[model samples]
Target: MAFIGIDLGGTNVKGILIDQSGEMLRQHYLPTQEDADGAWRDNVRDMVKYLQNYWQKPLTAIGLSAPGLPNAQNSCITFMPGRLPGLEGFEWSTYLGLPTYVLNDAHAALMAEATFGQAQHCQHALLLTLGTGVGGGILIRSELYQGLGQMAGHLGHISVQAHDDERSVAGMPGSLEYAIGNYSVARRSHGRFSSTWELVEAYRRGDPLASYVWLSSVKALAVAIASLSNALSPERVILAGGITLADDALFEPLRAFLDVYEWRPGGIQTEVVQAQFGDMAGAIGAAGFARKQHVG
Candidate 1:
C-alpha cells in the first residue's frame, strides 16, 4: 500500500510518498507562502493530488504535519496564531476529499523517529528539537501521548527557572526555550553572540564569556531533561534540530551536567542520542502516522 505525508512548515511544504515498508517512493517540496492568503494550503492539496496521480493508484492513507495543536478529531489545526493565518480550524479532510490525519509538526518529527529512525520500536521515548525555539514530543506504549488540547509535548515552555523574569513566546518564565533556543542566544550572551554557532565558536577558542553562557544553557537543558526523566521515565531521550550539530560542545557539557542533576534510580540513566532524520523527518513521520492509522 502507498501513503502520503505532507509537512507544512514556515518556509516549505514537504511531501512524500512511501510504501508499506517505509521506503520513500517520491518526494516534493513547495514554498510555504504563509502570508500569501492561504496559497500554501492549496499547494499542499495540489501536491497530494499530484502524488496520487504519480503512481496512478489509490493512496491508502494521508497525513498532514503542521505547526499547531491538532483538534481532538485530527481534522484541523485548532490553535495556530501569528502565522499561517487561515490554518486554524481549517478542515483538511474536507478540502482534500480524503481522510487526512493532522498532527503537530513536532509530534510528526518524533513519529518519524519512532517509526523508522532512532527511536524505532521504543515503547516509551522523548524527543526534543532544539532550534530557534525548543519543541518536543512524547511516546507512551508506542503511541504519541497528546494530552489535553494536544499540549503535552510543548516541552520548551516548561519553566526551568521559576524566579527569572524573562518569558518565552508561550509566556513561560525562564523556560528551556529561552535558555538554549536560538531565539534568546543574543540576550543570553549579553549581545556578544547573535547565534548559538557564534557562541560555540568562541567557546572553542576558550572565550570566558562564551564558555559561561554556553555552559549555563547546557546546564539548564540538563535540569529540564532530568526533571522530564523523573516524570516520564523514558528509556531514551532523542535530540534533534540544528542545535545538536554543536556536537561535543553541547553534548559533553550536557552529559556532565546530567550526571549532577539527574536522579537515576538504581543507577539506570536514560540514554541520550541524536535524531537520525533531519529536514525530512516531519513529512516521513506524517506518512508513518497515516500508515498506522490506516492499517488500524
Candidate 2:
C-alpha cells in the first residue's frame, strides 16, 4: 500500500509517497500561498492529487505534519503560529479528501527520528527543531508523548532570559526561540547582517559583535537544555533545524555551555546531536504516523 505524507510549513509544503516499507517513491513540493478566501486549500488539494497521480494509483492514506498544537481529539489545527492564516481553523482531511492524521510537526519529527533516524532504539530522547522558531518533541520509552492540549513539547517557548525584550512567536518573553531561532538571531543582529549565514560568517571571522550575539544565543540554548535535562533526564538530545547546520560553531559552544549550565546530582549524561533526516523528517514522520494509525 502506498501512503502519502504532507509536511506543511510556513514557507514550503512538502509531500512524499511511501510504500509499506517506508521508501519514498515520489515527492512533491510547492511554496505555500495564502488567501483570505482560502484558495490555498485548492492548491493543496491539487498538490495531493498530483502526488497521487504520480503514484499511478489511489493512495492508501494521507498523513499531515503541520505547525502548532493539534486541537484536543486531533481533528483540526489549533495554535499554529508562523503558518499561513489560510490553513488555520480547518479540518485538513475535509479539503484533501483522504484519511488524514494531523500531528504537530515537532512531534512528527521526533516520531521519524525515533523510528527511523538518529534516536532509533533510544528509550528517552528530546528533539528540538531550530528554524524560523524553535520546535520540540519528547520521546519516552520509544513512544511519543503528547501532553494535554498537545502542547507538551513547546521547548522553544521556555523562558531563558530574565531581563530581555525578545519574545517567542508564542508571545512569551525571553523564550529560547527568541534567543536561538533564526528570526530571533536576525532580530538581535539589528540589520547588521541580511541573513543568518552572514552573521555566522561574521562570527567565523572572529567579529566581536557577532560573537557576542551568536554565543549569547548558544548560551540560551545551553541553559534551556540544561534546565530541561534536570526535569526529563533524556538519554540524548537531538537538535534539528536549518540553524543546527552551523556545525562546530553551534555544537562546540553548545557543548561547553551545556556542560557549564547543566547540573545533575550524579552528572548529566545526555548527549546532544544533530538529526539524521534533516528537512525530510516531518514528511517522513507524518507518513509513518499515518501508517501506524491506519494499521492500529
Q: Could you give candidate 2's per-residue lDDT for residues 1-296 as a string of tens digits?
A: 88888887666678888888777788788766653355556656776888888888878788788877887656567876555674556888777778888889899898788867888879999999998788899998877889998988899999998677766667788999888777755568877875567778899999998999999989989999999888899988999988988899999999899778887667547888999887778888888878776664
Write one digit per residue (lDDT tens) for candidate 1, span 1-296: 89999999999999999998888999999898888987998999888988998868878878899998999988899998887988899998889987899999999999999998988969999999999999999999999999999998999999999899999888989899999999898999889999999999999999999999999999999999999999999989999999999999999999999999999778899999999999999999999999988664
Against the unseen true structure, what C-alpha lDDT does each candidate score?
0.93, 0.82
The clash tally of candidate 1 reads 0
TM-score of 2: 0.89
Candidate 2 RMSD to the correct structure: 2.4
TM-score, cand. 1: 0.97
lDDT, candidate 2, equals 0.82
The ten-residue window of minimal lDDT in model 2 covers 34-43
Best by lDDT: 1
Model 1 is weakest, by summed lDDT over 10 consecutive residues, at: 53-62
